[model samples]
Target: MTYCLALKMNEGMVFASDSRTNAGVDQISSFKKMRTYNNGTDRVIVTLTSGNLSITQSVVNLIEQRANDPDVPNVWNAKSLFDVATLFGECLREVRKETAAYLDQTKVDMGVNFIVGGQVAGEPQRLFLIYSEGNFIEATEETPFFQIGETKYGKPVLDRFMQPETTLVNAIKCALVSLDSTVRSNISVGLPIDLVSVKPNQFEFNSQYHITEDDAYFSHISTSWREGLTTLFDGLPAPDGFESNTQAAVTESAQPLGTPVAQTSTQHSQTLTPASVNASVAPVQPSSTQTEAESSSQDNQSSAPTTSLMHAAQNNQPAQRSPAVAANQQNTK
Candidate 1:
């Protein structure tokens, strides 16, 4: 498992990924997931990869090996970011084809994913998510971010805060928080995190950071975000009718067995209280006319109303009577 995310904003593009990968619990390792290709003058491309490590590594190695070849189009020589994404998808498919010879498709997961983004000389900055089938989709205004690999834990933060108009610095903060949220919840996505930022048409990275466990700013983000959420939750108002619910519970518990409970504002019907909410019965001193079994049956009848009353009070509805209990009450009436 892994976590990688990219944000495309009006100011530029931001990319981030965790370093941890594992074959199993016993075989944990760290590897760089972000790769860069740039010729300072003409173009710049950044890729964050996830899935089978060997497949991603092979695809990246292939791109680098063929980048300088004069006869073919490559990431370095591609005219636009779209062309670069296409070339990357092609290379990824080629790598999978090579591995498919011996590996069983059903038994082994050969799927891979990439977040490819940056600018070429004539085009604006663009971001894409390249899939295992050599297909890709670009980020747009409504969906200004993309995430791959263990995406659920970190996605709420990004969905709430990410926007096309967000500034570069704020986007970086959002990305780091998103990663931190994931790292705390998932063991597979650990740090040190690699981050890169690029401005539109700059054709080179504007900022790069590698955040480790002890990095002061990253530590502050983790602590502050946790504390802030705690404070916010503590300060939130309680739901309506909470006080009534609490009072009803207290009243229900205080009543003696066979005591008739008064209808509260929240309860829609009358009820008989039992000795305890758990429906337990204290040992009964059998009457002269009653046997031990008869006393036990009477205890069960008395406790049967406890469940229906508690549920009705919570839902502010009428208590539903069981058929046997209803018939017994009718006979008494």
Candidate 2:
């Protein structure tokens, strides 16, 4: 597994990727997943790859080789990001055609993905998420970022913190936080991350950072993020009906043992508008008042009344039932 993401913002764009790859628990290894192609004055491409190492390496090698061959239509001479991405897809397809058939027999997956972001001379800056099958979609104004590889764990922060109007530095900080979340939650994504930044129309990488375990800034970010989450969690109000300070009056302090006073409703709760009961509905437990003897006696009585009550509620005919009884009956069903 891997985690690679790119952000396209008002100031510029940021690209980041982790370095760890693993075949199994004992087969962990490190590999640089980010590759850059540049013509210095016209176009610059930064790609963060994930998936089968062989497939990704082959794709990169092919792209680089063809990029240097003047006869080939490469990123350097490509007029647009679309052309560059199409060329990338072609490179991916070429690698797949060469290796997938042989690898399939050995039961090795040829899957690979990429985050392609940067600029071409005349057009605006862009970011794309390239699929394993050589298809891709570009980032849009509504969602100005793309992430490839083990995407879920880090998604929450990105969704919360990123915006097209965000400064490039803040966006990169969010990206680092996003990476930190993935690294913490998943063993397959570890670091020595590669980060690259491209300013709008620069046609060259504006900056790059190689982050390793000993990096102080990353460590600080990790610490600050942890504290922030902790603070946020602590400050969040307890559920609307829940009282945090109540301790059930120590049970023994209750005048009677059936149900303590502290457990009773402080104010009448709004009648529950029961959602349609489904398979996940819990089996309702009988109250202490519904003892075996009492239940057996009541079994002889018409449950026909409760049935009518349930139908009334479901049909929106306000046949008033005591809140407690209504909740109990619904749970029973």
Candidate 3:
């Protein structure tokens, strides 16, 4: 198993992945999970993989082979990010076809996931998560990031902080914090992380850093974030109606052989109205341009029929008018 994360932000894009693969406790190994293909400043494609190491490696090999082959359509010749994604999906499928039989014979599952992020010339930076089946989904404003293996432990931090308009620096910080949380929770993920950042329309990545165990900045962030979390947890209010009892039970649970009492809510419940629920949920504001367009449409809808009627009456001849109006018009004429 591995962990790969990629973020698409307004400022740029950030990509990070770990480099640990293991078949068993005794067969642990390390391999670079991040790969980049740059085509003479015209485009740059970065790929991170997680899951069955053999399958992923095979997929990578296929991509590289086709990319360099001149005779075949590959990342270099792909016209758009969507084209690149399609190429990747095709490669993944080919690898599966070639290796599935052998892997089945060996009783190993052919599970692989890829997070691909980059830009082609004249296109905005995009991110995609490609599955083993060769299909993918793009990241968008509503969902501005993607993660591959061991994602659950790190997802909460991302859900709390990531946004399409987040700064690149802040996004990187969040990614690191997320990776730290995952590393602490799972042994399959480890240090020597690969990080890359690309500015929109730049055609090349702006920053690439390899964070090892001895990296000073990473160490500082990891420690500070952990301390901050502990402090924040400590500062939260205990549940009402059981504050003292809950604290006592928590303390007892920490003891070696104590039977701690389970804390249960004793407070009266209040029925929630739609307005209350709406107030609790965050409000999403529409763009100013959309609001303006809506207002203009309303104005046009209100005035269009009246203007049409007046123009029609002015253009009409005397006999074209209705009988009641024609009689009054003849008397005026």
C-alpha TM-score for every candidate: 0.75, 0.75, 0.72
| Candidate models: Cα lDDT each | 0.85, 0.83, 0.83
RMSD of each: 10.8, 12.6, 27.2
lDDT of 1 at 306: 35
The residue-level lDDT of candidate 1 at 330 comes to 94
What digit string (tens of lDDT, one per residue) describes model 2 on residues 74-183? 87778888888898899999889988779989999788898888888888888888998899999998998888789999999889888888998898899999999999
Compared to the true structure, candidate 2 yields what TM-score? 0.75
Total clashes for model 3: 0
lDDT of 3 by residue, 1-333 (tens): 788899999999999998888777887778999999885578988999998887888888888888788888888888888998888899899889987888899888888898888998888888999998999999999999999999998999999999987999999999999999999999988888999998887876789999999999999999999999888888787643234424522332233221212311333344544224333323345789989999997665534233345666687733234445557889998
For model 3, give the 10-residue run with minimal summed lDDT. Answer: 255-264
Compared with the true structure, model 3 gives a TM-score of 0.72
**Candidate 1 — which pairs collide?**
none
Q: Clashes in candidate 1: how many? A: 0
